[model samples]
Target: MTRPRATVVSLNQRIRDDIEARIRSGEWPPGHRIPSEHELMARYGCSRMTVNKVLSMLAAHGVIERRRRAGSFVARPHPHIESVALDIADIPLEVTQRGHDYRFQLLSRRKRRPRRGHGPEMQVAGDGSLLVLQSLHLSDSAPFALEERVIGLAAVPQAQQQPFDRIAPGSWLLQHVPWTRAVHRISAVNADAEQARRLQVEAGTACLVIERQTWRGEQPITYVRQMFLGEAYDLVARFAPGRPARRD
Candidate 1:
């Protein structure tokens, strides 16, 4: 057991960042096989063990996939939706506590330049990158909510690395990022054909759409719309006379 040298520690992070930058920049597209461990060891002038550790971390984070004797490749991205609670709570836990089996499916994900109309809502100007995700949530096999989200790449660059199939984007951000303020808008809307299909309800059915935008200080973190089936979900809040409720 030997400790990593100071130079080795620095090199490890540099190597990892370089590889990640290449992947995010599309230089190493999804399913692209990265250079072999031996090649990387030669290129970085580091030991095989250091390269292995770096690759392992990336693989564990779903950023890359490594096969036995086959080498590693960038993973294709998965769609994921982020949600916010005016009073933050674990959504899966909330559903389970209510005695329903919770499940969700990814619908779509895209990273592209925002449309001209999206500028004002996201507080951004010009053509900047936006990460969008759509998903459907179910309770006990019944459609519950449809989530659509747009995240600003400038504020959270790591958003590009997340494939939210296993973890909801909202939950992940809650755990990793800190936010200073959030604004919530609740409204009633009729389910359109697409929303109806996703919710397993007929078109024109009533729904509650909860739109939330959260920021870290002044930089926007994400904006999400959660459309819940009118009959399937409820929004609850508790308050005291003078004190504000807890937020996380």
Candidate 2:
């Protein structure tokens, strides 16, 4: 049986979705040339303007590239993004699950004024004192990650008293605070002398950094930076697109 054709009004959008599906499914992998506008126009029975419009949107979204005299091809695969879980991660459990002995050392715990730029970042009223915890995570006795965190006392007062040595601050905060939101910025950096010593890597080594901020309603709960030796880790994320509702 033949599939019913799309309506005129939905043609452009359906065409766009079909093209994107091919790219996402790796059918048209990076560097693969997509059909020309004329070819696509004939295949989809759409006007040139509609096809061009769809291609422009794809290019703007970095899914395809248009080159003079070269037509368009799938763009080189960018850092793929998958929806991340908002819940706090269990670092020790993650390490142990990966077949390694997990351990951590609480290097320092102190109450200090927020750094020059931290006050605004934390959305606090003043450069007030914050509980800072510095720790090192190890996998099978090898340095895995270094964590530096600052807690807003007003948001989680118990942070001031908790000895993070017994429970990682991340785990502690997840258990104590009712955070409604979180933001994560993942990036690569060249480890400096200080970070190098903390992660037990040579200076100038590449590292993966996760700068995370958590909030309870409008109040900031904590800001932490977890840096790991890049050579020792592979960050993975999985994404599943939303399915259309069933008519039945």
Candidate 3:
């Protein structure tokens, strides 16, 4: 059954427009399956070829999802995103997924005053801050990263008894404590001998450092410094809908 060129083009445009209208109007919400090609062709008076092209193009643009035996569907919405959000690059996670080895070691814990030399962002009180715990994390028997963390004695009365041998402080806090507010800062730092030795990299080499602090209500909960070994890993992100653009 042959159709005129004008008729083919008209049918194609109609099918594309119909699908686009449904998406813009939210009839096809994210992750919701759309009609199959046969259904779309039947409703739009279009050829299967035209429907396939339209769906394939939309899927490539992150607007839809195509799965074998499942037909086409709107994509899953991304997660809540913040401006100047996380951009983690050069941290390796590939080898571990292959069932490789990983390990952690607790170095020391201390209580200290907010000395002026102790980095600017960490401006705490003179009554002395909570506990500072240091440790190293390894992958495949090679040093992977170093973790330096501060704990809120008031937030978690159990901080004193928190063991650090098998579990890194950052992981322990997240699993055992609860926080309401969190701040994260990422930067580059030169490795000191200790950091260098633990990471198995040359001292003074550039490393990615992430500093994060969390609070429960107005009370501080945790402060942490996480340093990655090198540029073998990076962060990928997805975002959800923003607060309905404020209407005047």
Candidate 4:
């Protein structure tokens, strides 16, 4: 009797799953080099094309990183960070969850008209005036994040009446307003002098910035820019293979 050959699809998935399992289980830690294509092909009794496809998929998913002439290795995650889900939550609640005391300090509040050169936050104000707020969030008395926000008076007129002294603006907005949609933009930047002073980090230190805009129906509600120390925070997202990500 002759031994049967495994189908290409089955073998490909098998190899991919095995590698993923090792990485997830910490058997292959971050920066651990993956087996070369030739080695994988020989071990799995598969074609070079199949091994390449598996590696390509893993790289695309961020499970591993490929370097020119250096082969592929397990990817390292950001250091000294707290991973968060896609759905951002209240900052005060986040600090409490981390077993730290949370405090808010309102820096400034002003009402101003939108100007052409101000930026997108100002543009969201349309023809109406904006209630601008600046605040800082502290964890265990240490600077955690700095926030700058502008609320569209036409959309959330009540914001002008409330003094955001004890509570952070983001936390207050989440409670009083019902938003139909929100968009988040994340980036990294070196701290400027003012931001460095507020965040208590070196001027040249890297910071993670999250800019968010929320809307009620077609009307803009508020726009906020939050800056956090890069090593102190991280954002994580999980998704299924072949599934489209949620837009909102």
Q: Please list the C-alpha lDDT of all candidates, in the order they appear.
A: 0.76, 0.74, 0.65, 0.80
- Cα miss at 156, model 4 (Å)? 0.5
What is the TM-score of each predicted model, taking all chains together?
0.63, 0.60, 0.55, 0.62
Clash pairs detected, candidate 1: none
How much does candidate 1 score in TM-score?
A: 0.63
Instruction: Name the candidate, 1 or 3, with the larger TM-score value.
Output: 1
User: Which model is ahead, 1 or 3, in terms of lDDT?
Assistant: 1
Q: Write the per-residue lDDT of candidate 2 for residues 66-171, one digit (tens) a residue.
A: 9989999987744433323433577887888889998889999888777666544446323356888889999999899999888877655546667787788887
Q: Higher TM-score: candidate 1 or 4? A: 1
Lowest-scoring 10 consecutive residues by lDDT in candidate 3?
81-90
- Please give the lDDT score at residue 235 for candidate 2: 63
What tens-digit string does per-residue lDDT give for candidate 1 at 111-150?
8776666643446212357888898777888877789878
Ranked candidates, highest lDDT first? 4, 1, 2, 3
Tell me each candidate's RMSD, in Å, in order: 13.7, 17.7, 19.8, 18.7
Runs in model 1 deviating more than 4 A are 1-85, 119-121, 124-127, 246-248
Q: How many residue pairs clash in each candidate?
A: 0, 0, 7, 0
| Candidate 4 C-alpha lDDT tens digits along 121-147 | 676797799998899999999999999
Candidate 2: C-alpha RMSD after superposition: 17.7
Model 2 per-residue lDDT at 101? 93
